[model samples]
Target: MTATSSPPAAASRLDHLGLLYRDAEEYAERCAAFLADGLAAGDPALVAVPGANGDLIRDRLGTGRAEVRFADMAVAGRNPGRIIPGVLLAFAAAHPGRRVRIIGEPIWPGRTGLEYPACAMHEALINVALARHDAIVLCPYDAARLPSDMVEDAWRTHPVMLDGAGRRASPAYGDPVATAADFDVPLPLPPAGAARLVFEGFPDLPGVRAFVAGWADAAGLPSVRRPDVLLAVNELATNTADYTGGPGTLLLWREDAVMVCQIDDQGHLDDPLAGRVPPADSVGRGRGVLVVNELADLVRIHRRPGGTSIRLHFDLGIPPPS
Candidate 1:
């Protein structure tokens, strides 16, 4: 399958080191130029959000991109209906007859915290667009910030979003875990039909939560149980990043009456997230890990080069593996 190609032949223009500064016209002209280049090179057209370093590119091609870049421009809020439809409509209209060739902007620059949903919107939009065009969607985002459902959906559906550097949010920022998380251990072999959702290069937290929530919902888990998995995965995956210096791959599946999730990164751990449970803390210390261990019937750990894999098996219906 195209998704499984080893040593992909094409050099990804998605790296988009093309971040530049200029007026909208200049940006549109540059964008048009990129589109022309893509057209000549048989590449996808680049879609620019208001501020995604797309200034020069968009100025070169597009007459003028819209300012309604994201649904939620505020740094502390949640709103999707505000921005997604417009972008989707733009996509639908732009490629009316041609293939949906697009270079996506999952995050808008000069913005606060709207890139995440925007990324998800781009993801869903691209999936639909692909049905009509030979699409290549490249979205770089903070995996942790993704909406829980979208994250899960991305894992099951969209192609992998890779690790790339963005701003490390302020330490005072709403971080779910801490420095300790960058070192959790990886666990045993995962059940079949599970794969990886790498999160270390994450610039957003909402998306990751979304992925976790989605995973829980799909795995037949209740709402309360969902947070437990979400927190655990966050802590563990963060630990993976601290140790490996990159996002870890997540493997999810079902073993009997349980939904199993294993995280693999370039770290090693002797003491896993299970065993002796810790007491409730005043500030919620070790709670996430403890909850994860408590919820699952089987919590296994494994170690690999530069990383570790921790697997949490949540009950669903089938009996434990004999």
Candidate 2:
């Protein structure tokens, strides 16, 4: 009965729910109950999870149910950096006055090794991002699939935990800013074969795009994906050329099934949620970062005392024989 009970609406501005499950049945029962509680309270609900999990939740909610919003996190949140701005905050902003409920499954066994750290950072940052918002966000973790350490990290990031037994406060909860700050992993070095280009002014943007196109073709990137990579690179390079008031360096290389592009500049990306959120305009401002996130298969940013380095990944299958 406790599992089905709804927590007080005004109990907290942001309720971070960490759902730990061992099997599919357990996940379904708990998640369904949570959504049902939200619906009964007249709160708008959003469920963003992987494809299969979304199907399970939708099935539980029944057919022709129009109250709930659903999105495939695998596509919407492919870059964990974008989840906070693009998915969670966007939904919460759309429904202004009333409390909103979100079921977000960002971390799963399917995440790549390079993506796990960013995913973990995103989890930690959520606590800070939504601390003042009227929202209840449930972040589910598959204990059976993920490492024990990651499960432990979840406890530190989330303020509450929910399961078959019921909900409870997480004793391991800590300052989210501090927790996220600890996850500043350095960007990996580009391959030796990486081609480098330097651009000094906005006038150089066209040249930057041209450089990216040439490298993209040599890397065997499919024509379909080349445009995305070029756009991403152009956006980052433009940010450097315009904002930093100095030359920016662009690097390109191929590393097994993927094309890697990195842009370095003296500018600092102060806002962690910059590119993740959609911008109002197309040129200048944070729109470039948003475009980069939307285009790149994976994006990694390293900000140090000196400058910022952003690496963009594009998945390109093996090249055809010459």
Candidate 3:
């Protein structure tokens, strides 16, 4: 996409733009120009993209990079669920009432099949999350590398599309809420050899920790990360007991080089955006899910009328078999 001019100021407070670019040079040039214009207009700016692309944009910005907040999307946004609360909204909240410019590339070519659904959900939710906010978030996609369906999703999620063809309204844009609901379908069943643990209440919490630690060791999760995994499960399990009235199931397995921990409770998650935003009260049940999103590498949720299943994915630091 060419950065010839900014989106019109009257086009909603949250000017979410979808940029489909051909290659690295195109990505860097347009993104740098977007940030530069924001900076020149005295808008607080942020750039969160993958490492190599971020370096390219940083180099293109020259000395202007000093005034912007930069984050490694690969790390800060490992779980697409966390990008809104931990990155985008957090940046906007820091500077109240002021218009902000952000270039956020949440979906890229290398995203795994298991993670793509969450990324799409994230893209759709961005519309709802920033509907009334004074922020211009530019999201980029690699039209040259990503699959056709993924590119199609860019159209479904963003109301405006910007490419070499120029900016225009997306005729394919669907209601963001409906799109998010469609993606909230059930996750696939775990493999036959996966391990399972059942807990009744707070009394069984210790056993839950032991169960996670054993699998973390077998999955070769490093010692430092073991605590995070444990904390995530503990919080989820606690929520089960506190909110769902006990008797939750925990499933653990390793899919190639990634460790998976899924928690299933017999109650529904009434709030669709429970974990996507930070809780106003520290002691709220929403905090548990928020913590899990922040701690896990990837988080996928399947919530239905009778039950809710949340899966957390963590890399084992081992190469997958060829």
Candidate with best lDDT: 3
Q: Taking the tens digit of each residue's C-alpha lDDT, what string does model 1 give over 95-123?
A: 66544334444443332232233233334
Pairs that collide in candidate 3 are none
Cα lDDT tens digits, model 3, 15-129, are 8999999998999899999998998999999999988888989999998789998898998999999999999999999999999999999888788888899999999888877
Which one wins on TM-score?
A: 3
The Cα RMSD in angstroms, rounded to one decimal, for candidate 2 relative to the true structure is 6.6
In order of appearance, the predictions have TM-scores of 0.34, 0.88, 0.90
**lDDT: which is higher, 1 or 3?**
3
Give Cα-based local distance difference scores for all models.
0.43, 0.81, 0.86
Q: What is candidate 3's CA lDDT for residue 177?
A: 71
Q: What TM value does model 2 have?
A: 0.88
The local lDDT score (0 to 100) that residue 275 gets in candidate 2 is 63
- The C-alpha stretches of model 3 lying farther than 4 A from their native spots are 1-12, 217-220, 318-322
Considering summed lDDT, which 10 consecutive residues are worst modelled in model 3?
1-10
Ranking by lDDT: 3, 2, 1
How high a TM-score does candidate 3 get? 0.90
